[model samples]
Each structure stands twice: as C-alpha cells, then as structure tokens.
Target chain A: MRRADRTLGVARGLGWFSIGLGVVELLAPRALARGLGLRGQEGLIAGYGAREIATGIGILASRDPTPWIWGRVAGDALDLGTLATGLGRRRGGAGVALAAVAGVTLLDVLCARALSSRRERQPVRSFADRRGMPKTPGQMRGAASDFEVPKDFRIPEALRPWTSAA
Target chain B: MRALVWHGKQDIRCDNVPDPRIEQPRDAIIKVTSCAICGSDLHLYDNFMPGMKNGDIMGHETMGIVEEVGPDCRGLKKGDRVVIPFTIICGDCDQCKRGNFSVCERSNRNKDMADKVFGHTTAGLFGYTHLTGGYPGGQAEYLRVPFADKTHIKVPQSLTDEQVLFLSDIFPTGWQAAVQCDIQPEDTVAIWGCGPVGQMAIRSAILLGARQVIAIDCVPERLSMAAAGGATTINFETESTVERLNELTKGKGPEKCIDCVGLEAHATATLDSIYDRAKQAVMLETDRPHVLREMMYVCRPAGVLSIPGVYGGLVDKIPFGMAMNKGLTFRMGQTHVNRWSDDLLRRIEQGQIDPSFVITHRIGLEQGPEMYKTFRDKLDSCIKVVIRP
Candidate 1:
C-alpha cells in the first residue's frame, strides 16, 4: 500500500525550516552569541551566516535603496551583534549561558526583520556615496578595490568587448 | 499435442513421442493446461542450446493441472492447479541445503545421479538440450516433474489464467532480478529491456521502493508499457541512452542496473522501424551487445549489478576491467527455484505483487507448434504466452 503523502510532505518541509534556522544563527555573532549561551566565541563562528546574508542581500539590493538597504543592513547587523555579545554579557566576562545566547538570537532575528524593512531605502551616509546610484556591472567593477577579490582574477573578459564612446 | 523435437541445426518437426509418466519418488504428472513459448525454447529451435539430440523435447516456462503423482509425493493432489519453475532441484543436496537450488548438486546433468544418490552433487533439468538434463520438457499435453513438492508453486485459486500464468518464468525471473540487486527505499534502478522480464523488473523496482526507474526499449508498445508502469522510458532507437541516463540522474546515474534481456534479447543496433525491418537481422541466436556495457556505463560506482538473464558459461566480449574498476558487485545465476517460490507465492497470495500482469496471450495446448513459431518469429503482439490444455 502507498504511504500517506501528507506525512512525507510535512517531514521534508520541516527539514527546510531547520536549514533556515541554522542560517539565522550563523548571521550575527557578538550581540546574539552570549545571550543564547553560545560558548567561547562560538557566536563569532555562527555570525558567518549573518555576514553571508548581509553581503548577499547587499549585492542583490544594489538598486535605488543601495545605501539605505545595504548600509543599514551592514551597520545594524554589526551593532546588534556587538550589543548581544557585549551588553547582554556580564561586565566581568560573562560565562556562557544558554538563555543569554537564545536572547541574543531572538534579537538578531528582530534585527534581520528591521533591516529587511529598511532595505528599501538608498545606502545610508555610511559606506560610499550613493550618488548616481544603481551601478552597472562595469561600474561595480570600477568599485572593485572597495571589496576584496581573489588574487587569481581581474576585471572579467565579459567587459573587454565593451568599447568606450570616447 | 506433438512436441517440436530439435534434431540439429535447422532440423526440427512434430513427433508423436511416447507419453510422459511419473518416474521419481517425488514426481507428479502435469497435463499441461497452459504453457507459454519462451525465448529459451527458441534456443532449442535455433540449435543454440547445447546437447539437444534428435527429437529432444523443448520448453521450460509452463503451468498445468496435476494429472497424477507418485505415492511418495505428499504435497500435490490430483487435479491440483500448479505452476512449475523452469529449474528443478531436490532439497537434500548441498547446493539446495545452501538455498542455491539452481546450482543443486543433483542438477549437474553430467554427473551420475545414482553414484552420489545420497550426497548427490547435482540433478537433471527438463528439456532445452541434453546439457540441461536430458529429461523431456513440456512441449506436449503432458509433462513429468521430478521434485514436485519442491519445484512447483501452487497458484492461488482465485487468480485467472492470465494472472498466475507467468509465475513459471518471466514473472519470477524479474522479481529475482529486483531482489538480487537489493533494491531498497529510494533506490534508483534502470532496467535494460521491455520484454516480459524487463517489464516485470520495472514493476518490481517500484514495488520494492525504488524512487525512480528508467526503462530502455526500442519497441513502441513495450516502451509504452514501461511508462505505464511508472518508469521513465527511453527509446534507445531515438535517443542516446548514455545522455538520457545522465540527464535523468543529476549525472551520477542510477544506483542499480539490471540486464533482464540477457545475451540475446537486445534489438540489433541501427535497425529500421518496421517489425520485420528492425528484426531482420535479429534472430533467435542474436547476441545482446552494448546493452550490458551500457548498463555498466550508466550504473553508479559501487552499485549492484544483478543479471537474471540466462547466459551460458561461454559469453565473450565483456568489459571485466571496467566492471572491476567501478567496484560493481555482480550477482547472477539461475533462480533458486525451491528457495524463492514459497515467499514469492505468499507475496502473490497477499496481493503484494501480481506476476500474471506480463501474460500477453493464452492459447490451447494443441497450438504449441504454431505458438512456438509465432513467438519465435515475434509475429504476435506477445510478451508472455500461455497455452491451455
């Protein structure tokens, strides 16, 4: 006899949900780390998710909301991470507390939602000037030194055929 | 009905041979009610099956009613319905003891049956050739089956002729392919053929929990049936099998691949579409080519390769090195008729699987000769054929 589809469907759906949860935990380190009792700078390791999500979203949301979206996202992400790890921890080097780590995780989740909402505006007065805004691939290439590129690569050959009007 | 005795190459005819009778202590006489013309039968017709003497009876896959039995035969009653497995084995031998009924010590025809009677190394089998045990097979209305208690599976009373018919060969062979390959939950299997055995292999794969099954066949009808069985069918005539398999699997390929067609069933490469056109060069003696090689090519590394297809010890041109390099676990042999029958019967009885689905035609016992010719010629739209006495 065939198995009930609903049973298997729910099981698979739950798996995807867990992946998202893990991703959230990895995005912000300092602020959320200690609150949830993420021990021994574990939150820093977990912050890899937040860093990836920030950079990914920053690259994707490079339109009219450039600074407003990416800037606020980068700033608040770092700020929330620091507060969760610093203020939430005991002044005299707080020991790892599960509740502390969880509290920080909840704050990071809130920070993500806040940043996603403000993600609609231009880059804030933080990073680079947003004037003339949404950069093309070539302009993004020109702005390359602003971000690290692996030593093995250079401006892509895709732009080599782009003859200048001058 | 007269038997089509194979005398020599291209030499055959009807023979009003002496009637068969129970000879062994555990023997039973079956007045064959239905028997199918199997591809193996063609081995005798084409003089390919060895040791076929002049007037040797020919046929293996069959079913009929128990007409008589030796007094020592306890399980089968007169008029009882039964389906006989192609290979016979006495459960007392060493091979039988190990549950390898196909390789039973008493079945090694070349050995003396009485010399080692108690600690017998092998036994004989019904017709194909003298090499297969000079005992006559079921090409006539009657046949004598030794080891009746251990060799025949009692068909369920409720099943129709079309439903329990192929329990004799194709059906069980397909199941054997699936089981031997160790098909498991979410396993992906590919079967090479759309003949009766291949079709059943596809069915067994799904029933055994293979998440995806790919079937390769050139015939339109057979390929369509494979698709109906929930397999992703590929017409090797039109598409590159390697490309299709690679596309189906995200490049890694299927976990298990079965060569149900054996060494002779592969349709010849580069053939025209017409039945006669595609089959012009393909005779009963045709050899299976790249299909086996292709199976090895597309199967996952370290996967199991199960061959339920019959092959003589004389097969050549195989890629042994590649098979070794890929770490393929190969398992092949004649079906351990005695070992698999009871469990397979229960599976059928419980409706876990229906083996008769492969039966394509049912004829009378007297039609044996014509049926053999039609099936051999691939003339009828027949996949599985049965004869009613």
Candidate 2:
C-alpha cells in the first residue's frame, strides 16, 4: 500500500484500541480493573482512565500521532508500572495482570523506538561536509581579540629601564 | 653566486654559493628579474628562522621570466613574465583541492610531493620557518620554483613589471585583509602597522569604499604615506588612537580594524630599533596586551577585526571574554594569493590604483643587506625599499 495510507492505518488501529480501553475503564472502573486481573490496582486504573480518555479524544480529533501515540506509550508505561505495584499485593490474579501490563510496555517501547528512528532517518541536503572552512586571519573562534594601538604618546623609550641583550 | 646568508643572531653576509637548478619535473628555474628583502626576511637575517646551516638562501617575493620550464610543466612556458606569490603550491594536492593553496600538501620542496598524497600532514612554506616547508627563498640571481603553475600569476602584457610587482604578496595580502575585515561602505576602518602591508591595506580600503580609513603607525614616512593614500592616520606616538576613534565615530569607534603588523613586524618607538623582535609575546607576557587592549577599547560593538599580521606559535592572555561581550565578527587567514592578484593587476591596468607610489627606496640587488637595515631602522623616509635584482 501507499506510505500515507499505511501511516493512517496504523493511526486508526491505535486510536480504536486506546479509545476502547478508555471507555471500558471509565464505564466500569473497579470491575473492569478486577476483570482484567488487576484485583487491587485502583490508583493505576484511575490514571489509565484519564490517559485513555485524553488519547482517545486526541486520536479521534487529530491525524497526527505526536499527541496520540506519545500519550499512549508514556501514560500506559507509567500506569502499568504503578498498577504492577498494586497487583504485587494480590494473589494469582495479580500475576496475569502484571504480565499483561509488561507486554503492553514492551509493545509501546518498540513502537516509540521505530517512530523516533523514522523521524531521524529523514533526508537532509544542506549543512553537509561544511566543517573547518577557511576563515580570515585574526578571526579566532571567539570574539575579536585584536587590540588597537592607543592614541597619544605610547610610553617613551628614554623613560624605560635600558637593558642590553644578545 | 653570492647570497645574503645568515650566520647567527644579528649576522648576515653576501657570500658565494652554488646557483640553483631545475631539480624536479614541475620545477622551473627562474633568473631573478627582481627580488627584494622582505620585512619577514629580516627574521631569517636574525637567525630567527632556525634553519641556518652556515648557508641558507632567503627571499621569496619575486617577478621574473621563465628561464626554463620543467619537462612535465604545462601551463607556463619559457620567457613568460610572471609574478610569483610567496606561498607556492602544487595544484593537484588535497589542500589545493580545498583551495587552501598556501598550505598545499606538496608544498615541501625537499621531500617528495608524494608525501602529502600518502596522507601525510606535512605541507611546508618557503623560508618562513621549519614548521612551514622551509623551502629556500628567492633572494638570489637565480632560484627554482616548484609547483610553478599555482604559485605564479601571469602579468598582463600592457603593464610593466614595476606596476604589477607587488601583486605577488603585499598588495593582494592587504586586499585580503581589507576584504576579510568586511569594511562597510560608510563605516570607519582602522589599520595598525602602517608599514607596507598597512599602507596597502589603507589603499585597498579606499578602493573598497571605506568612509574613513585610519592607519596606525609611528613611522613618519608611513604615516605620511597613509595620509597621501587618503586615510586619516594615527601616529601612535603622537595621537591617542582610542580617543581619536571615539571622536571620529561618535563613541562607537571604528567599525572595522585591521592589524597588518602581525606578530613579527610590530615596530614601536618605545622599543629598541636594533632588535624589533616579537613585541606580541613580550607585552602579553610581561606587562599587558598593549595594542590589542586598545583595539578592544576602540573597536565599535559588533565591529569587524581583520588581522593580516604574521603571528608565531601560541600566546596567552588574548581577551577572550571581551571579544564575546562586544559581539565582534573576526576573519583571519593567510592571503589566498591566487584569488586576489588577478583583480589587483586589473586595477593597475585600469589606472584606478597605483600602489607603486609608495615605493620610496630603489636600490640594486647588491644593496640588499644595507637596505634591510635602513628599512629596519625606518630611516630617511623609506616607506618601502624596492630592490632590483
């Protein structure tokens, strides 16, 4: 497919996933958290709820991923880490939910890395092989260090202490 | 043949030596049509070049007909009148490719030109110092020119040798300094060291449309020459250069300043004339940065500072902070001689400028030593000594 179409496809897929997660968390809160095997993750669920809502709104409204994908990756990572702490205090339910959060983090990291690399690898034509160009003499790296000879009488030689040298 | 050889500190002689010959494929043997003792040659005279093995030839600035071109030489032919720039280069080197022809990779005449081609960082110069290639200079009746095509500029047939002689070094060098200083059309430009380069810098500044060119030097003849060249001169011993600059520019001071004296040729009346050594190191080390201090004080905020002076290796106490505070733009480099000489020659052809007007002392080649002393003493109205070899 075309590059623009592929980009839009990724954006749409990411938007639907994040928005679905947001609506579910907002609607059920504790039950959704518990059903997702995060039995005691109240604080983490609340944070994810807010982040999901914001990411959902941004993704539906704007085509750019800078606002959407960035919030999803960063906000999900923080919420998942916090939720992992709460799950640590629970029983067998805790292990599955923590594992799920860890998987989400790995996916987010890989996507973020790919996106950043893509931006960096873009072509640039100017400012290439332009170092060490010849500059005029007396113009050093810093400001002008040249001092002008002062006006009026410079110190007369007769007054200076005369010393003979080789 | 006789050479003005340097024996030791303050010792020089005209002694018999074997004449030079065409030693390489690119070299051309030039019968010296004209050669003069440069202010820089005085460094070799004082044994400052540190290459004296009892006999070393000194003299680089020259104009002559090609006596013999090497077998491989292409552009130059026998009997072609050319003015040789001091910094010679082989055109096919890495440095030459980058247009830094002065420090060409194959500039060293002693070593094989292949040294630079093999990625050796050993580009040298003619008799400046051992640090530079230490090629023998052109003060003799005959000299070999390696890398002949790049080093020499072809003079126009209409112009006499005397008219275009200085396009080799001093004239183009001063022009480079002027252009590097970035002197504005209506801005005031101040030049230090009204020696030959300083004088030429003023002349070039006038041609480039400097509203006011103030030349700084204590030498009466040079100061007067600056005045004749239509520049306001600051005779450092007489005038307060800082005060005059402030007065002239309404406290903004000069918009651009050019230092032509470099590190070697800073001749001050306060210093002894017998040994006009590196005043730059002496002042900055012992007392204070005397002249540079003034340049800082007088130069306008965000002004241009051009230095064409020859500075030897390394010094401390350059006012690093002050330069940043003032927002000054600075450019400094060895003259791209080939770039500036052609246009300078055209000016002489058009009668728009006559730089030879500054030539005050005319002497034969035999008088090289004595003339060096005279110019060194700065005596008897000697603005520039022109020696006919």
Off by over 4 Å in 1: A1-166, B9-14, B112-123, B265-267, B270-289
lDDT (tens digit, per residue) of candidate 2 on B51-116: 345566667678888899888878999989888888877878777776666667667654453343
Best candidate, TM-score-wise?
2
Considering just chain B, what TM-score does every model have? Answer: 0.87, 0.89
What is the C-alpha lDDT profile of model 2 across A69-102, one tens digit per residue? 6667777667666555555544436566668767
List each candidate's DockQ score: 0.00, 0.00
CAPRI quality band, candidate 1:
incorrect
Residues B1-389 of candidate 1 have per-residue lDDT tens digits of: 56656677645556778888888788999987777677667656655455668877767776789999998888889989998888787778777777777676665455653234324333466776555477778766788898888778788688765666667777767777877666544467889887778887777666655667898876666676676666788888699888999999888877788887665553324321122222222342234445667777777877777888765324435688888898777777766665556665665666555666555667755566666655554445556677665
- Residue A20 displacement in candidate 2 (angstroms): 98
DockQ of 1: 0.00
